[model samples]
Target: MDHDETGCQAAPEGPILCINNCGFFGSAATMNMCSKCHKDMMLKQDQAKLAASIVNGSSSSNEHESVAAAVEVQVTSVEPKSVSVEPSFSFGFGSGESSEAKPKEGPNRCTSCNKRVGLTGFNCRCGNLFCAVHRYSDKHGCPFDYRTAARDAIAKANPVVKAEKLDKI
Candidate 1:
């Protein structure tokens, strides 16, 4: 409950303290030992195992080599893997082309006037790309039936609800 001279509060006594008494927080995976102490313990265990194997003289040179190879594999597996990423550009209005496929006239050109619209190209419902001027249905003379599409959409969204006819009670 008291603050030290450095203006930092001291850690209260609890079961969370490291069992190794190293004045650090304990981890459940490391048998309640701090990370540094856990690593040291692991190294000591590995060394003891190696020593015991050597003293027994039962393990062959081939077995030792295999163990070393396994350890090397573990070390390599722990390292982060390198990933290669290639640049992919996709315009949603294209003819379902793959990422690797290149466009014939590039995506920047407007289909109506063939003008360079760049990022300002508008996508029409008729599957044609257009510039700002020809973005509207009337401007591009779009053949996709707007009124029919709207009526169909509305019908689909709002289904008919009729009251059940009752017979004479």
Candidate 2:
């Protein structure tokens, strides 16, 4: 907005307010503003900064998307795809080959090596899918601690002993 639109004439004496005109007791709280007029100017500056940040952030996200696309390309190159062309017997009607090709489904990959694994691969209780080699929690560097298993086993084996110990304690 222009200086005229602000309705705030330049202060003749003070940096804050028009001491000659309206005694608008100014707010010095933020942006050195005596009134809403100055806050409007600051708001525009803040919005500009926010817009610049968003533009810069979008560039970084484009870089990340490129890396993901590269990975997808690599996976496609590594896999062998067999295209099955169905024979169309229909001259005008239908032996019926589907116009669109169906996407091929591939086996699940091991989280550790990114190698394809069959149905025999293990899905760990810790929630990770791995191959037979890293099937065990210990091998996969799983964070699940099984210390409670021993305690549960002992509690089950000597229930009376545990009851006596608890009562004594």
Candidate 3:
């Protein structure tokens, strides 16, 4: 989730820093953070858990406190995480006229038919526009390069043909 330059006050950028020492896993994860922070926190937690498991095996006394302290230290060190910033919406089209509004695009036009067609997905390579009927569903629609898709489809289909050949051999 992106935010403006002002920064996201709506939520914490990092996992709600492990407040409870009595956490079931040593640190209670309150809520989700941005992807990057969440990944790091999970790694640290895994390490802490491994350490706790090992320590518990060797010592009969209360090793939980030591593990909790370690988790707290790890959590504190990950402070001041960054938030993703969303781009601002704008309506300026490249038109030089400040007063005239940009013309709205009508229905999607297919390159092959030159007519309005349903959007399956757009072609990435040559940009030869396509509708659902013209699309290859197995390849995630006609968005990818048609030539590439055709070649890939042939290659994929060859496996079945080859199995038949092997049986005859």
* Candidate 2 Cα outliers beyond 4 Å, as residue runs: 1-106, 161-169
- Model 2: number of backbone collisions: 1
- The 0-to-1 C-alpha lDDT of every candidate, in the order given, reads 0.72, 0.59, 0.51
- Candidate 1 regions with alpha-carbon error over 4 angstroms: 1-105
Candidate 3 at residue 120, lDDT?
Answer: 59
User: Per-residue CA lDDT of candidate 1, range 1-169, in tens?
Assistant: 4466569856546657688798998866788888999988987786567556655866788967744433322122332575443322222335555435554865587778999888888988999889999999999899999999999999999999999999988
Which candidate should be chosen as best, given TM-score against the real structure? 1
Colliding pairs, model 3 = 2-86, 3-85, 3-86
Ordered by TM-score, highest first, the candidates read 1, 2, 3
Model 2 over residues 1-169: C-alpha lDDT tens digits? 8779999776546556533235655544544445565665676675465445444665367755543332221122332565433222111123465434589967888888877787777887678789988888878898765778778888899877333445545
| Number of clashing residue pairs, candidate 3 | 3
Candidate 3 segments exceeding 4 Å error:
1-102, 136-169
Total backbone clashes of model 1?
Answer: 0
Clashing pairs in 2: 90-95
TM-score of 3: 0.19
C-alpha TM-scores of all predictions:
0.38, 0.29, 0.19
Least well predicted 10-residue stretch by lDDT in candidate 1: 70-79
